[model samples]
Target: LDFSIDELAGNVATGADTLSIALCKVSAPTKEPWLTLSYDEWICVLKGRVLVHHAEGTLEAKAGETIFVSKGERFRPEFPDAGTEYLPVCLPAFRPDRCIREDESDATVGQQVNDMHAKLQVAEVLYHMCSKEDWEKSKADNAAYFPPMFDKDGFTHATSVPSLLLTVANNFYQS
Candidate 1:
């Protein structure tokens, strides 16, 4: 019931690749890359409008309207109106491979998504999964070593037991 939309971005909430449903909020007018899907997709707009450009031409859908993109249809989605909220459902889910984006060549939405996913996955693996890299870093660090993301993260994770600090650099941070 309580989950982050960012946590769902570039990833699925269902944990199943067969299907995915996500609510997307676009606060600013933004444009997305041309995407060719391997799965059928339905996008229902909840607020503002969405502009989709395809080979045939362009299609415009506003609030309360729904747009369907069949498999293999290539298109670019744009949110011309700020504060656009929409729900996108994908049949067979939306993997990076399933969503072939043409903007990977540049630092576009696809690249940004991949980058975000990489950072999130790294954090998950290093913190939750306890990778050897974290072990080495934690072991070698004698002083209060905050990771590179400490500033943005605002706090460091610490252990309840001082002796177990070797096992974890930072945990259970309370600010």
Candidate 2:
């Protein structure tokens, strides 16, 4: 489903338990305001420059910058003086019950931190979901656009042969 922060806050149709993935194309000169999520979110910038602001700090993300946002944390993406695009996946489907709108004096601080960690983990998982070869190819092609530490060493260290096989089979069948 296509989405922008505006559509999300507006009276648009949304699913409760359904997960949604979208490629967001942020136009030049656009900086979305701070917004909170109901479900965990994974964000990976695919084009241009993007800026993410959270309680932890501001993360400047480019093509290879992957980010995770836990449910209920007040966060948002800004263009940072350049247009950008991103891929975002929402798990447990972004239901209203899962989101708490931004407030200056919210009480749920600890939960937000946990959620942020969860979101980042999920983003890392998705980043490596593609085949190692494919991942490497993209990494090379976009080396200039990627962060300095962009490498597939982590994938090699983390994935077992059986796990990779399962992932490949699942992706093949699903596709």
Candidate 3:
């Protein structure tokens, strides 16, 4: 697909049940007032840093960090130090039908970014790597694929393993 920068765009991802993927480049002195409703967002910081002002708190995200912005939250993301490049994923997908934007005057001011879940960043990476293709394909096929909420060891009945050799081999190779 082709990509273009629109002068009229809010520089934010807002949509519903629709998945929008874009490699965004955010620069300093850029703060856009925006809000979303139909879906939540999981933003992965690939380069530089950016700040997100939300109802719960404000946060600063640098390279190698990921942030989740829930739906219906009044938020405005900006880059104060240099610029940043990142990948943003919207749950259920970002559709214009779900986004709710506030007036530019109501945007958050001088807020500090505070992330509560940074460790989940690793899991997000693994999850996307494993399911990104499936997600992309499932969207086209009209199928649904969601990750399990709990590990089998914690919630499911135990099953006997026919062979521990494969497990050992896989573990050694992974390590």
Candidate No. with top lDDT:
1
Better of 1 and 3 by TM-score: 1
TM-score of each: 0.58, 0.46, 0.47
Compared with the true structure, the alpha-carbon lDDT of candidate 2 equals 0.54
Residue 119, candidate 1: Cα error in Å is 9.3
Candidate 1 lDDT (Cα, 0 to 1): 0.67
Candidate 3 ranges with C-alpha deviation above 4 Å: 1-18, 105-175
Cα shift from native, residue 92, model 1 (Å): 0.7
Superior candidate under TM-score, 2 versus 3: 3
Candidate 1 lDDT over residue span 68-124, tens digit each? 999999999888876788888888766676778777444355664565345322112
Least well predicted 10-residue stretch by lDDT in candidate 3 = 112-121
**Candidate whose TM-score is highest:** 1
The TM-score between candidate 2 and the true structure equals 0.46
- Give a tens-digit lDDT track for model 2, residues 113-167: 2343342222223222345666687678885233222474222222223345556
* Model 2 deviation from native, Cα RMSD in Å: 15.3
Kindly report the root-mean-square deviation of model 3 from the true structure over all alpha carbons.
14.6
What lDDT does the true structure give each of the candidates?
A: 0.67, 0.54, 0.52
